[model samples]
Target: EAGVTQFPSHSVIEKGQTVTLRCDPISGHDNLYWYRRVMGKEIKFLLHFVKESKQDESGMPNNRFLAERTGGTYSTLKVQPAELEDSGVYFCASSIRTSGRAGSYEQYFGPGTRLTVT
Candidate 1:
């Protein structure tokens, strides 16, 4: 019954360092998504997980990023050799799958984790 939760609400790291972010979605929810908003950019979808499988990941930026959902319960995103441009607010959301009804389901979002790369 819990909403999504993110760990280490804020992170600060220098460029070329590695950072990992975590998200725990609501119970019984099969849809989990990751998003981010960099400076001067709109919030963009990074990837989506339906249970343990990746449903969509076309939005993932580059090879430096990796996302995984283990056991379809919690998810993690890691950025290696982080760049200054990676500084942003990372958001995680989850929602229950509805029967193909438009506007019938709403995604619940977690308090975003702010990352700063210097």
Candidate 2:
């Protein structure tokens, strides 16, 4: 089985620019998540998607960010008018669906996309 994969490995952009990051989760995984680490902060959850529907998105920072999982095959995170605070490593993770229980759903993460906003 293949692991989660993120496109563009790295990106550099000026402030107010728009950037889109893509992630392809492992085949057959139904639960996808978007996470990020900005500067000194710990890796934080951005959103969660179950198949093609958004399951949770409380961690999203502001209206400038948008996440989508069309057809539930891959996911994309877009930052419009990117700001300096958005510079960081964006991570993608996926897991199989499981009942609500501890340790039942193990997540596999991708290498991450590094975004640098100037």
TM-score of each: 0.93, 0.95
lDDT of 2 by residue, 1-118 (tens): 8999999899999999999999999998899999999896999999999999999999999999999999999999999989999999999999987677543268999999999999
- Candidate 2 clashing pairs? none
Candidate 2 segments whose C-alpha is farther than 4 A from its true place: 99-104
Evaluate model 2: give its lDDT. Answer: 0.94
Error of 1 at 38 (Å): 0.5
lDDT agreement with native, every candidate:
0.93, 0.94
Q: Which ten residues in a row have the lowest lDDT in candidate 2?
A: 96-105
Over 34-62, each residue of candidate 1 has an lDDT whose tens digit, in order, gives 99999958999999999999999999999
Q: Which candidate leads in lDDT?
A: 2
